[model samples]
Target: MSSAEDLQFKILQHPNPTSPEKRVELMANPTFGRVATDHMVMIRYTEGKGWHDAQVMPRGPLSLDPSAAVLHYAQEIFEGLKAFRTKDDGIAIFRPDANARRFRSSAERMAMPQLPESLFVRAVDELVKADRDWVPSGENASLYIRPFMFANDAFLGVKPASEYMFLVIAAPVGAYFSAGAVTVWVSETYTRAAPGGTGAAKCGGNYAASLLAQAEAKHHGCDQVVFLDAVHHRFVEEMGGMNIFFVFEDGSIRTPPLTGTILPGITRESLLTIAKEKGIKAHEEPYTIDQWLEDARSGRLTEVFACGTAAAVSPIGAVRTKDGEVKIGDGTGAGPVTASLKESLIAAQRGQANDHHHWVHRVL
Candidate 1:
C-alpha cells in the first residue's frame, strides 16, 4: 500500500450543487438508500496501461457500449464504508483501510485489475472532502460511501474485459432498519455459496443471486433471510447482507468461521476484539440449525444479533423457520451484551471512546 502522500487527486467542483439548507433538509430524515451527495470520484483502468484518470466530478450517468461486458457478463464489484461526524464535531471514517484491502481482494477474485489500497482510500477521501457538507450528523445518520468497479469493455467475449471504470458515490443515510429487534426467515431452499465459490468476494453477482431468497423471506413476514451451508443445509451461515452471531448465557459468543463460504465482515472482526476486552469469550466455529433451535428454546441462548457496515449491529429477537419459531431472551429488544458491545463499537467510531486500535481515520 502506498502512503497517503503518494496519491494526488484532481477535483472539479459541481456547478449546481445542493445548497446547504436543502442539504440539511435531506439529511434531516434521510432514508437508507435514496439520496446522494453532489459530487463523486471516478478512475479508469486498462489491461496494460493500469489505473489512470482519477477525477472528482459532479454526479451523473455514464456512457457505455451496447455490448458492455458488465451489462451482460456481470464483471462488477463494490464496497461499503461510512464517514461520520464524530462526537467532537470532526469527520472520521471507521477502518476504511480494511475496506480498501478487501476491495483489492475482491478484484483479484473477480479477475479484474487491483486498485492500490492507498489509491482507493485517496479516492474516497477526495470525494468526501468535496461534498463534506453532505455528511449527516443526525441522530442515527451518517454519510454512506459506496465504491464500485465494473467492466467497461464493449466486447462480446466470455473472457475478462480489457477496460474497467471505478467510481465512488456517497449518500446521507439514516439507520439501516428500525431500532426494534428483527425477525428473520431461514431458507432451506436457497444456498448463498458453496465451499469453493465467490462467497467471500464483495461482488454484485452474489447479491443478485440472493434477491429471490430475500423476497421469500419477505413473504414470510421477515426482514432478512438466513442461508444454510450449501452442502448439508444444516449449519447456519449468515444473513443475506450481515453476519450472524449467537450469544449464550454462558458469556460465550460464536459466529460462523471464515471457510471461504461467508463474507469476512469488518464489523464482525471489531466486535470479536472488543468482546475479548470485555471478558466475553468469542469463537469462530460452526453451530447448526438444530443446535440453534434447541439452545434458543431451552434459554441457553440469551441473544442473537447481526453485524455489518450499514447497521453496525442489530439485535435478532426471533427467527421464523418452517420448523417453527425460536425466540431469544423473551424476544424483546437488544440484550445486555448486545447493547454494551454496540455502544462501545459506535462510540469508538465516533471518537467518544479511546480508539485503542486506532481504527478511526479523520480524513478532514
Candidate 2:
C-alpha cells in the first residue's frame, strides 16, 4: 500500500467520442444525471495493496461479481458536486478539496478504504479534463460530477469489505427544480437519520430509506419531504436530500444543527461562511416543527430554503403537514435573502464574484 501521492492516472481516450454537433444538442438542455460524458475515472482499492489501478477510461457498464458486497449489503457511498464553465470561458470545480475530505469521512464511517484527498481531486480533474467539452456554458447549466465508492468484496458477509472500487462520472445538467419556490411535505411516518446512525454519511442506504418517504411527499402533491429527528420526531432535521435553512423577519437565519443526524452539505457550509462574511447573523440551532409552523404563520419566519450540491439553493414556499398547510412569506418564490445568497454562491462558483475563500478549483 502506497500513499495516494505516489499514484499516477492512466488516461485511456474514448474510442468513439460524441460528435461536437451531437454534444451541443445534448448540452442544450442536459437533464440531471441523464446524459453522461464519454469517459470516467476509476480507482481500485485492496486491503494489502492500498489504492491502485487508477485510470480515466471509457464510461460504460461496470462488471461485478454476483456476490459483490454492495449488491446485497449496500456498502456504498457517493458524492455530488459540479464543474462550472467560468465567466471567462474556463472551467472550474467548486471546492473539490472539501468534497474530497467529506468522501474520506464517509469512507471511514462505512468501514471502507479512505481515498487520499489528493488522489480524489486528481481523479476528478482527470475526468473533467478528458471531457472538458462536455462542460456547458450558461448561467444555470454546469457539469454535475459524481464520485462514489462501493464494497467490491465478492463474499457473503456482514463485515467491512476488503476490496473496494471508486469511480467518478459526470453529467451536464440544468436546474434541478422548475422555476419558483417549491412546496414540501412533512413526513411523520418516515425519519431520515437518528442519533448514532448513518444519517451523517452519504451512503446509498440512507437515500434508499428516504425513497418511500419521498414518494409519500409526492403522493401529497409536494415537491420534497421534510424529516424530523428520529428521537423526538418533532425537531426539524433536514430535507430528504438537502439541508434546510430558515430566515427570520429580523434578517437572522437559523438551520438545524449537525447533531450527527444530517449530511454536512458543502453548499450549506459555503452559505454559512458567506453569511458571516456579509455580517448576516446565522445560527445553527434546533427548531421544531411546531415552532416552524407557528413562526411562519405569525410572520416571524420570513423565508425558507434548501441547499445541496444537486439543487444548490431552492426556496421552500409552503409546508404541508397532516394538520394543514402553512405558507412561508406569501409562498410565491425565493425571498430577497434567499435569492441574494443563492446569487452570491453561484457567482463565486462560476467565477463571477470575488473568490475570497479560493473555493473554486480551476481545471481549465
Residue by residue across 1-364, what tens digits does model 2's lDDT show? 5877899999899999999999999989877899989999999999998999999999999999999999999999999999999767899999999999999999888888889899999999999999999999887899999999999899998999999999999999999999999999999999999789998899999999999999999999999999999998999999989999999999989999998989999999999999888789999999999999999999999999999999999999999999999999989999999999999999989987887799989999
Best by TM-score: 2
Stretches of model 1 off by over 4 angstroms after superposition: 1-7
The local distance difference test score of each candidate is: 0.91, 0.94
In candidate 1, which residue pairs get closer than 3 Å at backbone N, Cα or C atoms, i.e. clash? none
Error of 2 at 252 (Å): 0.4
* Candidate 1 residue lDDT tens string, 110-223: 999888898898899998899888887876778999999999999998999999999999999989989799999999999999987999999998898899999999999999
Lowest summed lDDT across 10 adjacent residues in model 2 is found at 347-356
List RMSD in Å for every model shown: 1.8, 0.8
TM-score between model 1 and native: 0.97
Q: What is the lDDT of candidate 2?
A: 0.94
